[model samples]
Target: MAVVVALGAFLMTLFGGWVAQRVIDRRHLVLGLAGGLMLGVVGLDLLPEALSAAGDDLFGVPEALLLFVGGFLFAHAVERLLAVRRAAHGAADWGAEPGGPAKGKERVPQVGLTAAAAMVGHSLMDGIALGAAFQVGGGMGATVALAVITHDFADGFNTYTITSLYGNDRRKALGMLVADALAPLVGAASTLLFTLPEELLGGYLGFFGGVLLYLAAAEILPEAHHDHPALSTLLCTVAGVGFIWCVVGISGG
Candidate 1:
């Protein structure tokens, strides 16, 4: 049953990616909406759930919160390391120019791919959660499925947008989108073999939430406004957040 429901998620994800592909010309709006959706998922959905599930506190800080901070720092560090490496390689290849390599352009594709990979992992977990919920009861399963299906559009959209925004080729973006689309099904099937611990799940969610937040705040949102700087782009972002909020509220109710 879980697997069957996951099929819906798959289709929705593909549809979302298709939408992103269609809007390539309006890159700013696509990015704005994606950024807003990421912010909403991290703040309104993932963090709250992580806090609820991982109830352990260490030195007056929730373990999930600690992991969240760690994930953010880790993402930042990885991007910087990749940037430095690219800079060095470019200098070696092109003969040490006065200004060095174009760090901004060179490092973007890596970051996009990394961020898209994280989204894939998140989708995998979503499927696992869907399957686990069904194990408990159909009611629980349906509710979880609803949440997963709803947000997965955003997932698909972001996966494609992020991959392409950073200068990755269309084929690579589509590949990531397909992977994202399939993740939930794979995750749901895995649940038949074993269940994940709630604490572990919480920790993972918290960490991923942080990674996503950093992408939205530090990468996606800035990129959205960098060229366009239009009111419509900002509104699209707000609409994205509102859309997620509504999804969460509905799921909770």
Candidate 2:
């Protein structure tokens, strides 16, 4: 049952990805919406949890550092991959060349690999959220499950849109759709692993928070800045954060 719900949640995320693809021409808008949504989630949700999870202990300092660094490193690796792709294409191939698709397929695999790896943490975070949902009693658990499904739809749309735009891979975009569709199932199956010591729960959640934070700051948000008016992006970002805050309050967390 949990697996079914988890799968449904991930599929919703993929559906978001599919929908995101339609607005490919306006990549900036896609990134702006996705980045704003992700950043808002981080501001209203992930950052606070990360701070609280660190607590007032000396040992936890390192864990917090680990969480931040892990996310940062993930971003760095992705950036490096992008850089390498650009270098291989001689700076001209990245949408500037007059070659007109004559030589762009060489790095498609790397593009896909980098994309999958960079976005991979989202899967684990979904699993952790699932693990968290199991706590709200059976009825609340069901509601939580439904909520996961709902948000994942947005998440999928964002990821699909960004990855497809960046990697320029239609197949990979579809693959993202498929993968995210299956992610909730994987998350549901992961409950077996997530059922852990209560003391360790905060650390787990913090890590997930870090992943979300990294996605917002590194992938989606930066893309929002690309080829768009700064003022427009800034306003969208604020609105997103404000909206998320309102929703978070409604969620009572």
Error of 2 at 250 (Å): 2.8
**What value does the lDDT take at residue 60 in candidate 1?**
100
Write candidate 2's Cα lDDT for 1-253 as tens digits.
5676776776667666766756544645655655566566555665455455455445546464466567667656655755523432232345677665645554455564455444445565575566554642343245345445645765576556445545557876677667766766666677766465432444554555565566567655665674566777777767766766676677665
Q: Candidates' TM-scores?
A: 0.63, 0.68
Per residue, candidate 1 scores C-alpha lDDT tens digits across 96-139 of 46564564345567877887887798789778877876764564
The candidate scoring highest on TM-score is 2
Candidate models: Cα lDDT each: 0.76, 0.57
What are the clashing pairs of model 1? Answer: none
lDDT accuracy of residue 227 in candidate 2? 53
- Could you tell me the lDDT of residue 221 within candidate 1? 76
**Angstrom error at residue 68, model 2:** 3.7
